[model samples]
Target: MAFLVVSRYSPLFAILFVASLAGLHCESPGKSPAFSFRFERFEKNRSLDAVIALYGDAEISDFVVGITRPAVFSSGRVVYRKPVRFLGRNPSFSTYFAFSVSSPDGGEGLAFFLAPSSSPVKESTNGLHFGLPPGATAVKFETRTEPETGSHIRVEVGGEISKQSSNLSNVSLVLHGGEKVHSWVDYDGDSKRFEVRLSKSSDSRPLSPLVSYPIDLSRVLQREEKLVGISSSSGNSTQTSSVYSWSFAVKRGAPYSMHSEPLDPRPFVVRARESPPIHLRRTYPWGVFVAMVFAAACGGLLTFFVMFVWFALIARRPVAPVEYPVHPVEVGYQQIELVAGEKGVDSTKK
Candidate 1:
C-alpha cells in the first residue's frame, strides 16, 4: 500500500516542479529589456543608482535632486547618468513628473530636456538660457512675463526658442503659485509626435494635452544615446523649484537602426557632410510649402474663371441675318408676228 501511494503522488510532484521552473524562466530579465524608474521621494543619504547631479545648486533634500535651493541668480540640474537606448527604429516613451515653484517675486522657472550625451550644462545669462544645451529639445514652464508673450508653456527643439504649438488657455496655470503641478510628456517615435499634458497633483491625467507637435528627434539627438534631465533657474529672482516625484519608461522591442543614414558623432559645426542645423531647415520648409499651396490655389481659380468667361461669351454671341442676291430677268418682245397680223386686219378694216 505504501509503494502504490508513493508512485501515484510522484507524478503530481513532478508536474508542480515543471510549472515552477516555467514561471521562473518567464520572469527572467533577459527576455524583456526596458528602461524605467520611479522616485516618489528623495533622501539626502540615499544613494541614487545611475543618477547624477550634473551641476549647479542641485541637491537632494526632502524631494528628488532636481529641486533648486532658494537663492537669487542660481540654477540646478539633475540627469540620469545612463544614456537612453532605443531597441527599435522608432522607440516611444512616457514620463510623468510633479514640480512646484515658489517665489516671492518673479521667477524664471523650470524645464525638462533631452539632449545628446556630449552636451554640457549651459549657465544662465541675463536670466535667459534655462540651462538647455544646443541641439536639445525642451518643454519650458515660464513664470516670468515677456514683452510679447506673457507667462506661457513653450516647447522648443534644436535650441531654437520659437513659439510652440499649444492652447492659449495654458497660460492660466500659475507657475509660481507653489502648488504641485503634474506633467506628462509622451513621445511616439513612429508618428514623430510629442505631446505634453498638465494638471494638478490631486487630479488624474488630463483628457487633452497642453501642447502637441510633430518632430523627428533622431535629427536632433544625433545618436542612439541621449541624456534626459530637468533644470531650473532663479534668474535674478529668489525662487525655489521642487520636484516631488518622477517616473519614466521606454517601450521595449527588437533593436533596429534609428535613421536611414548613419550620422557622424562629431559636432554639427565640424561635420562637413551633414546638412544645415535643424532650426534653419525646419523653419523655412513650412513657410515655403504654405506659400506654394496658396499660389497654386489662386492660379487655379483665376484660370477657371477666365475659361468660364470665354465660353459664356462664345455661347451668347449675336448672329447676323443672312442676305440673298436678287437676280434680274430679261423679257424678250414678240411684237413682229402680232404686228403683222394686226396690220393686215387694220388695212382690211380701213
Candidate 2:
C-alpha cells in the first residue's frame, strides 16, 4: 500500500499533470482581416466546422491562409449564400483577390467565377471539371503529364459546358513541388479589364514572375451579380492537393495592379478595446490570486486529513504483549530426607 501510494504521487506524474493543465488552459488570439464569413477545417469532412459569419455591407479584404489536400470531393463549392451579397454598389476601381494551393501532385488545379445559382456542378479528377456555376467562366491551371511529352502547364477557359483550350505560349510561370504561390486578380470597372498574376520564389534571382494574363471581365460574366470563390480537387490516381489562403477586395477607384508588398505573415498582437485582458481588468488579478491561494490551502488541508486518518488507524490496532516469568532461588542448604516413620514413633515411645 505504501509502495502504491509512492508510485501514484511520483515526481514525473505530478510534472506531467501540471503541464497538461497549463496547456489546456492557455488561450490563443482570434482570427484577423475580418470577413463576412471565414471557415477552416480538414478535407475529410465537408462540413464547415469553424466559421465566422458577419452581417451588413462589410467587404472582406484579407485572409490568413492555410490548406491540406487529397480532399474527399473533387468539386468543393463555396457559395456565398444569399442574404450575403458581394459588390453591392458600383465601384470605380476593380477588386483584388488571391488564392494559393499546396499539392504533392501539382498536376491539377482550377479557379472559378461563380454566379447566383441554385445548383453547382463538380469538376473532374486531375483538373478535369472546373467547379463553377452554370453560365460562369472558369480558368483551369492544369499541370499534368502529356501523352507524348513531359509534364506541362495548360490553360483552359470554360463557360457552362463549352470549353476553350489554350496552350500557354509563354512558359514563364512554373509551379514547383511544395511551393507557396501568390496570385492576384484585379477587376477594373472603368476599363472593363481584368488581370491575373501568379508569383513564386526564385533560387537564382529575385521572386520569379509566374504568369500574368489580361482578362476581359465583360466577356467573362454573363451577369454582373455573381458570387465568386475558389474550388479544387485531386486526381483519380490518389494524389493530394490543398488551398492555403484567399482574399477579396472591392473599392471605388481606377482598375490598377500592384504587387503585394512582402510582409511577415506571422500573427501579430492586437489589443482589442472591448475585450481587454482579464488581468488588466480592475483588481481581478488580485482576486484570482486570493482564490488560488485559498484553493491550495484547502488541498493541503485535505491531504493532512487523509494522513491523520491513516496514522490513527495504525495507532488503534491491537498488539500482543510479551510475558516474562520470575523464579525465586533458595539459599545454599542441605536437604533432609525422612528414613521412615517408625524411627519417629520409637523416639516418641522412649
Candidate 3:
C-alpha cells in the first residue's frame, strides 16, 4: 500500500517540478524588449495625437517640429508623451532623423537623446550640454566650431560632454547650412557597437558611419522607462533647428532593418552621403585637366582647318593679265607707225 501511494504522487511532483523550470525560462533577463515609432512629419492639427510633448520653446507647425527659437538663451525639448520601457539586460536600438539648422550665425546645435523619464530639463548655454537632463545619453550634432574640436558629433552620458566620438572638421556636410540633414544612429547590444551616420535628405545612408564607438547601453542607461526625444538650445548666436522626420525602434531577436517604412508619407529619396575617397579626390584634378586639354586640341584643329581651307581654295587663285582695248583711231596710228618711224629717223640724220 505504501509503494502504490508513492508511485501515484511521484508523477504529480515531477510535473510540478517541470512547470517551475519553464516559468523561470520564460522570464529570462537576457530577452530583448520591443518598441517602435516613426514620425515622417507632424500634422497641423494632430500634433498632440502624435504622442509627443513639447517643452519650453519647442513647437510643432505644418509637419515640422521646431525645437528652439532663434534667440539667445532659447532652449527646448520634444520628447515622447509617455515613458517607454527601453531597458533590458542588453538593449539595442536604431533611430533615423532628418533635421535642419539654419541661421545667419549657427547656434550651439541639437541632439537626439534618451534620458530617465523622471529627469527634469535643465536650461543652460553650457556648450553641448544644453537642454539635457541628468542621466541622459545623447548623440549631439555640434555646428559651432571651436578652436580645439571644430564641428563634431559626440556621445554624452549623464548630461556631461566628453571628447568628440567623431570629428567633422573635414567633412563636406555643413550642419548649419539650413538644408535638411539626415542622420542614423544604431546600436548593437550584443556587440556593444554604437554607430552614427550623417547625410543630406537627398542622400542615402552611408556605408560607413562617422562614429562607431563601443558602448554598453546597460551601463549608460538605467533599467527603467526612458524618454526619447530631441533637444536644442541657442546661445549668444541664434539658429533655427527643425525636425522634418524621425524614426526609432528597439531591436528584437531578429536583425533590425535600418530603412524601415515610416509612419507617414516618405519625405524624399536618399542617395549616398559618403565623401569622395582620397583616391577619387586626387584623380579629379587629372580628369579635369585631361578634359580641358582635349577641348583645346579640338579648338586648335578647327582653327587650323579653317585657315588651310581659306589659303587652298579661296586665297591662291591665278591673277588675270592687264589688257588695253584697241579703238579705230589707235588702228590708224598703228598703220602710220612705219612712216612715222622713217620720218623720225631722217630728222635725226639731218
Candidate 4:
C-alpha cells in the first residue's frame, strides 16, 4: 500500500521541475534608447560651438569652452551662434548648457541666455549675465564670490536670487560629491506649461522643482534666427576652466501627452505566447554532488536507526505474571476431613 501511494504522487515531482524551467524562459521588455553628447573643449579662441537642429525647423544653441582670463579684468571670453526660427506657431525654448567646471582659483563662473543678436557677451561684473531681458523668464545657477555673502552658490529665477542653504534652494541644487549634476526645462503640452527640474547622479533624492510657467509660443521670433551656445569666463585672477559635454532635445508640434489612465491590461490576452525555452544543462560539480548525496543518504540512515531503536524499546518491555503465590500459613492450616473419611472406612471394615 505504501509503495502504491508513493507511485501515485511521483508525477508531481516532474511537474514542479517543468514549472521551474518555464519560469526562467520569461524575459523583460525592451527600453528606449538614451540620447547624449560629450564635448572635450569649447573656447572662443578654439571657435568651438555645439548645435542641435530641432526637427529641422528650430535650433537650440550651446556655447562651451575654456577661458584664460577671469570675468573681473575681461581677458578671457567665449561666444557661440546658430540659426533658429520661432514661427509663433510652435514653441521655442533655450537654456544655458549645463557643464561641470573646476577652476584653479575659483574666481568667476558661467551663464546662459538668448540675445537679440547672435554675438557672445562679456562675463558680467556682478554675475548678471544670467539675468534675462525684461519680461523674459530665465533661471541661472551661479557659484562665485560675494562681498557680504563671501563664496556661495545660488539659483536666480526671473532675476530673484533665493537665500543660499546647504540643502537645495530655489536656484542651485545640491549634488552629491563626486557625481555629475544635470538640470533641464521641459515643456508639457497637456498642462500647456514649462517645467524645470534638476537631477544629480549621486543623490537619490527626488527631482528639485525650479519653477513652472505658462508657455507663450507666440512670443518667440519668426523666420530664420540664431540660437546662443554655452559660455564661461574667469576673473582677472588666473584660473583654467573647461566644459565636458552638453545636449538638447526638442519636439516640433504640440508637446506629447505623457499621462496615461491606470489599467490592469493583463487578462485580455487569448493566445499563449511562446518563448525560447531556457536550457539548464549544467549540474553541480561531480565531487560536490557526490558529497551532498552521500551526506543526505547518511542522514536518512541515521534517522532510520533512531526510529528502529525507539520501536525495539517499546516492544521488549517485561510484563508482570497474572497468578499470585499462596502464603505458607494458609497451606499449613488445611482441614483434616481427609483423615475422617479414612477412619469411617476403617470402622466399617472392623
**Global lDDT of each candidate:** 0.63, 0.40, 0.67, 0.38
Q: Which tens-of-lDDT digit does each residue in 1-350 have in candidate 2?
A: 54455465556546645655664453222211112332322122223222322111112332222221344334444434432233323332222223444445443654545544433433222333434445555545554544443223333334532333333324445442545444544555445444445544332211323333444444333334445555544444223333434334343333333434432222111222333221111234665666566567557655755775586567566678988998998887655554457546322221
For TM-score, the strongest prediction is: 3
- TM-scores, each model vs. reference: 0.58, 0.43, 0.63, 0.40
> What is residue 134's positional error in candidate 1, in angstroms?
3.2
Flag clash pairs in model 3. Answer: 203-271, 204-270, 204-271
1-350, model 3: which lDDT tens digit per residue?
Answer: 33454465557645655654565445333332366776656654444455777887888776688988878767788887767675556777888788888756757788988888777754443433557766788888887766677668878876666437445757678787788888888888777777888876666777677887776666665466788989887767777788877777775332254335322223432323333111111124655666566557556655655654455555346568999996765343222222347447332221
Supply every candidate's count of residue pairs whose N, Cα or C atoms clash at under 3 angstroms. Answer: 0, 8, 3, 13
Name the weakest run of 10 consecutive residues (lDDT summed) in model 2: 49-58
Flag regions of model 3 displaced more than 4 Å.
Answer: 1-33, 46-50, 122-128, 252-350
Residue 12, candidate 4: alpha-carbon lDDT:
59
| Alpha carbon deviation, residue 128, candidate 1 (Å) | 4.6
Candidate ranking (lDDT, best to worst):
3, 1, 2, 4
Top lDDT prediction, candidate number: 3
Better of 2 and 3 by TM-score: 3
Each model's Cα RMSD: 28.1, 22.1, 33.2, 25.6
Candidate 4 residue-wise lDDT, 39-109, digit = tens? 32222222232332111011122333343333343322232334444333554342313344344444454
